[model samples]
Target: MGNVFDNPSFFSKYMELRSDYNYNDYLEHPAMESLLPPLKGRSVLDLGCGYGAYAMSFMRKGSSSYLGIDSSSHMIEKARTENAGAGISYRVLDLKSLDTLSTVFDVAYSSLVFHYIEDFDALLRNIYAILSDDGVLLFSQMHPLLTASYGYSGYFEGDYFAFSSYQEEGRREGRWFKEKVVSYHRRLSSIMNSLSDSGFIVDRVLEPIPREEDIREFSQLERDLVRPTFLCIRAIKKKSK
Candidate 1:
């Protein structure tokens, strides 16, 4: 398989792990929600929208339309099977092919997705093009600090690749997945500059710290209080002159 996500068993296990409270639930999701703009009556493009976790939410919140795209067919299948809403549709499409998107969106969101693709600039440029002028693009990615360390030193050692195998924790016990996932790490400055060069005006950058309530439920998250593992961002497509 090209990446761990493309493997059937791995993707299956990942779907099963949706209820768990490790990274997705405890850390990333809240931060992403915090950065989101109003959804009512908007058209949304959800890039890397694995399993469509946020699909129905967009529809329920009154989005006029919602298109959720992921690279994995397995994920798209699960998304369609599990989630049903009038205005939401899920498709299998890789991030690099965003240039093929013809539909314009009022808001675009990608949660914990961008780190897997190395061509960050091109990805942003395509998203910028697909967005209506002044549309918002909100996303989250693996933090540069955590990626630079990988398990060791934290002194911003430049870009590199890291691999992971999923597991379960925090009152939940099981093998979440059985494959090695790979991601690329770029410096914070590089990430910012790439977005700016791609015509995204950075509105806010968030380094999410675990909430006290989350830590109460998942005590291990207290470690993350010191070193945030994820970065959530909100940017806008610049208006044409």
Candidate 2:
């Protein structure tokens, strides 16, 4: 509905599922955080910050300020309503237009949103422009392995894969809620190469697996523990003097 991500009804249901299960709390978020440097007293730009969930986490960890942007008004509204407080703001803005943001951030945090964007080069360039000289970018996406697991030709070459899903929209599904969505798959090389071309130095990469404790609680995650479902990256903007 509404291009897979902008629908109000779908987001409402999706947010419900998020809160019910802490779905992302256990997955890529923890692994991504482990790769990040201290964020205390830092300003953050949260791209595709759905419902400001990760933004709230950053703010709680002593981030000086958090600006969350997304393309869905419903998600923005829910974020503003649920996450209203000091050191936080939410806006309905598309990632393709990141130049509109004037503030330079010390950390630009995005999670599981890049695959939805078709123009990785432009998006990374825009992020590089608004980032401070030493700004760090931390983000996660659907792992290339997971995409290949679905079976596709040219798995090694840079390519795009499209699929239709009427049940869910994230790397993993919760029990209660589902919605119609579309997915775009691209090669890992293309993702990293684009970051390099956009003036970012790739520092670390992680194909996250479920921790032993996690699999102990949710035994269903044992399969994911063996095979990574998500990829995380840490990079820094190489701003020229």
Candidate 3:
């Protein structure tokens, strides 16, 4: 999964896509921003923080410190060059090695990265261990409905969309930017249960609806009205009893 983004062609195509107005800007970012807790005086650990895109926003919102970690050295290099600032730093670290992190943070944030991880339970447990009591974990990922179907085809069969294989949770390999990318599919119930098992209290879940203006501007986003493309979650660490 990490190497996919590091591939020169994939990385270039991805950066170009993100640079323009797109779904992340129209739907996902708005939903994520709505779920964010106050960052004033807090420290943040960003898992799979590609290119540190949101690092400066955290600082501008009054976060005392921000650390963005990504598996791609190419991403970390761009982050350091573009998003570098006081109290902001970037590291080349895979999400699977999260247990190695010793510093507790007030907030753990990830965007569109959790689905790539196979062991959801272990990821939640690692995040739980590194968060301060009452710390927040906020993340977004591809909606299960979007990833449930194998081969990533037959999504729109004529007027209706095909959704299946939701009960089976495991690897789902598909093409993105003309390259094969792998991601995991877990039901909404599984996601909630894992968070509970890891001592997190689910606070909010969002399946964002594209704004009317956005839809009017980017006509392609109208498809999202039929089925959501992303899901956002906010959970807090449970205080020890």
lDDT tens digits by residue: candidate 3, 24-141: 9999999999999999999999999999999999999999999999999999999999999999998899889998888999999999999989999999989998999999999999
Top TM-score: which candidate number?
3
lDDT of each: 0.77, 0.74, 0.90
lDDT score for candidate 3 against the true structure = 0.90
Question: C-alpha displacement of 133 in model 3, angstroms?
Answer: 0.6
- Judged by lDDT relative to the true structure, which candidate is superior, 1 or 2? 1
Model 1 clash number: 0
**What is the lDDT for 9 in model 2?**
69
Report the CA-based lDDT of candidate 1 relative to the real structure: 0.77
Query: How well does each candidate superpose onto the true structure, as a TM-score?
Result: 0.86, 0.82, 0.96
| Tens-digit per-residue lDDT, 1-241, candidate 2 | 2444566666665666577654366777788889876889999989998878777778788999999999888788878998877999998898988999888899998888886676778888899999989799999986765443332332222233333331332332212134534445567787888888899999999987777888787665565655666789999888772
